[model samples]
Target: MTTTPGAADWRAANLANWDERVPIHTAGSFYDLPAFVAGRNTLRDFELSEVGDVAGKTLLHLQCHIGLDTLSWSRRGATVTGLDFSAVAVKAANGLAAQVDATTARFVTADVYDAVQALGGQRFDIVYTGFGALCWLGDIARWARTAAALVAEGGFLYLAEYHPVADLLGDDGATVENDYFHRDPIVVDAPGTYADASAPMAATVTVEWRHGIGDVVSALTAAGLRIEFLHEHDHSHFRLPAGKGIPQVYSLRAAKTA
Candidate 1:
């Protein structure tokens, strides 16, 4: 595991890389910005059921890029605040909200570690993070603790993530290319991204950390959240096929049952 001090370099690299991806992601059909502007919610079916009613709830979406999903939550009557480390992404998110004329959604540009101070002492009924988020951070323990701190006393954390098993697979999305149990950073410098593999990328290098379902549960529990339930699924948000009979994604529901 990269120590807190050593992870700074990797985090900076990741931040720069992500900042550059914002415009590309917003332009891509994968995000479907027009659909969002047309009043469509980007969240998947299962997530809605798992998260239950957000009507009149306060929701904080961490690592929310460009606010599509975050605004969707606002449409469901949740007072939403979308947070991301990239300024460009946050700017675009705010722009989308303005374009859609959504009043309940807000965006904040800040790192996951600084979320509390960035949000001005606000807490939420639901602390949400979705697919492709956890791998960017070197510290799951700290990440989970921050999530707990963001949750209101009676609220919970709702997470949907690409399964560790899915991350281990090579580009073919079939052959295993890495260890599932490794709690270490896997430094990568590649050209394409998951959203649009063919799109040219200026920021090619990035660092990713791997965490399994067990790691996720342990971190949340260690941080004082109660284990509610965990379920694995065979589908993913991306267009690529979740390899036959493979569990490609996982959902975790934990609570601050104080």
Candidate 2:
């Protein structure tokens, strides 16, 4: 069951909702700061291997919550800039960077739609985003254009996201809980977040869109980016329901045309 709303309204509501979730996610165990300090690569192997070498490349991370993965890229020798809608997330990200002694990375607090204008024509060798990112936006085409606009002529854009199919399933284990093909916003009135299941949360609402694989590919293609690759897997970063098992790799990557 999806509640449809106008694109603008949906986007505005989502931005505000994510703003509140930023701190909860940063302090959550799923992001395990102690493990990260011990040199564990929080990113999956598929993403790491497919993204290849970033040595000396300029990388921009979109919706970079708390900057953990963005700092990880910087540690691999990329000059990195992270952008997110939440001011608190950017502050925490900057603080984490200082703590990690990562001088090559910077964090900017801005909505993705406005970042290009704020950046003053700055572009990057790689524009990257990760799981659970795309749902926040109401317009996939606009998001794709934003991504393409940020990539330099010879550079590329990369994304590794959860499969849309997995999103349609219900916890009841026998039905489709949501509309998979709906192009409108689905309102979720819930407590707590996906990051910290135990934390109590205020009763808040959020709007999300379920973009199918074709929609994703078409949006990027319409934005003039050639699809490099699209891989699917059985697993996701967090656990799904019964019969859903972890894959050896649960990531996908697609690069822009050269």
Worst 10 residues of 1 by lDDT: 1-10
Number of backbone collisions per candidate: 0, 0
lDDT of 1: 0.87
Residue-level lDDT of model 2, residues 1-258, one tens digit each, is 467456667666666666777777777787887676666566667777888999999999999988888988988899999999888789988988888888999999888888798678799999999878888887889999999999998788888887777676665434567676888667887766887766666636788777888888899889988788877766543546435643212343445555
Give per-model TM-scores.
0.94, 0.89
Q: What is the lDDT of candidate 2?
A: 0.78
What candidate 1 gets wrong by more than 4 Å, as runs, is 1-5, 171-173, 237-239
C-alpha lDDT score of every prediction, in listed order = 0.87, 0.78
TM-score of 1: 0.94
